[model samples]
Target: MTVPMERHIARTRIRDSRLGQHNVRVNPGEYFVTGDSSVMIITVLGSCIAACIRNPLNGFGGMNHFMLPQSDEGEWNGVSSHMRYGNHAMENLINEVMKSGCRRSEMEIKLFGGANMYVGTSEIGAKNARFVTDYLREEGLKAIASDLGGHHGRRIHYWPATGKVKRLLLTGGEDSRVATAETTYRSRLAAAPVEGDIELFG
Candidate 1:
């Protein structure tokens, strides 16, 4: 008998005096930013991508989760910054770190997630990883480490204060099922269609 599939949950916790914790489901085109000394966590599976960026010199960083490569014509909204895209995600991350008093030339990069969860489908994870690598080389940013392109989901934790990353694998195991369920719940909350002009965090 086929067993029921279990769910998964991805969580990121921050433990620094100068940092804050910001958690979000990170839908197709949404992104979140954490200040210096903070950390960001994003979980993903097939067809989705997340980029982790940090300034090693000053010990600060940020991450962005993007679903598609770029939006087609007639689908541009100004809710999230353009940096949410693979193309823009790299550029904007550099700019944000610079604005925080760090040099672009000294910035370091670490990447994770780009799983081909859907078997026999397009290699979206590989494409995403390529996009990020090309962007970094074109921009002259050094990539020190990476964990990309797989068939399983992943839970990634990024420390903006130190640029250190912790990765947790998610598989078809019972534990993974529970995590997946929790992730689904949180994703529903993050993807809830915004209502009439109301405060998001108020």
Candidate 2:
């Protein structure tokens, strides 16, 4: 069974004194959706992708952070495995926003956070960028803006209600943190068990 979206929504909430708004930090394998203008969603990415989707008509939107392009077939037994892949991540975020009284036809899309953190390793960042690009095309959706496929990481702040985003490219130590976090996350997923039934795509 694929875990409910509630389990995947980011919970690390904080009050941004500078911005005077509530900010939620989204990690890999997580997403958060809301219609509230006061809430901002943020994430750091290294060889991962975060999709920002919102409905301009209703001011309802959400974001998803995922590390992989697609889950392996029959690898759907673990809850974390689901949202960690682009296919499931995109679908869930879009569905949640639509469920908040927004229609798919009214959605605006923005893409961010695919960096080639691993120098000589397999180009997972490129793979992720390619996957999302293909996924959006297959679903007949278009991104109005994007910053993807570089040699550095990025920090993203997004207001789902307004479809506004601020991106800060990570430098030196900041970039290292993102790469380290994703490495640990990937390790954990490798050790995690298969337990859900969500369909996988490539």
Best-fitting candidate, scored by TM-score:
2
Backbone collisions counted per model: 11, 5
State every prediction's TM-score relative to the real structure.
0.63, 0.84
lDDT against the true structure, per candidate, is: 0.55, 0.77
lDDT of candidate 1 at residue 48, scale 0 to 100 = 56
Which RMSD does model 2 reach against the true structure?
A: 5.4
Q: lDDT tens digits, residues 32-70, model 1?
A: 445534345455544456676665665555676654433
lDDT of 2 at 28: 90
Candidate 1 accuracy as lDDT: 0.55
Candidate 1 ranges beyond 4 A from true positions: 1-28, 36-42, 69-84, 173-202
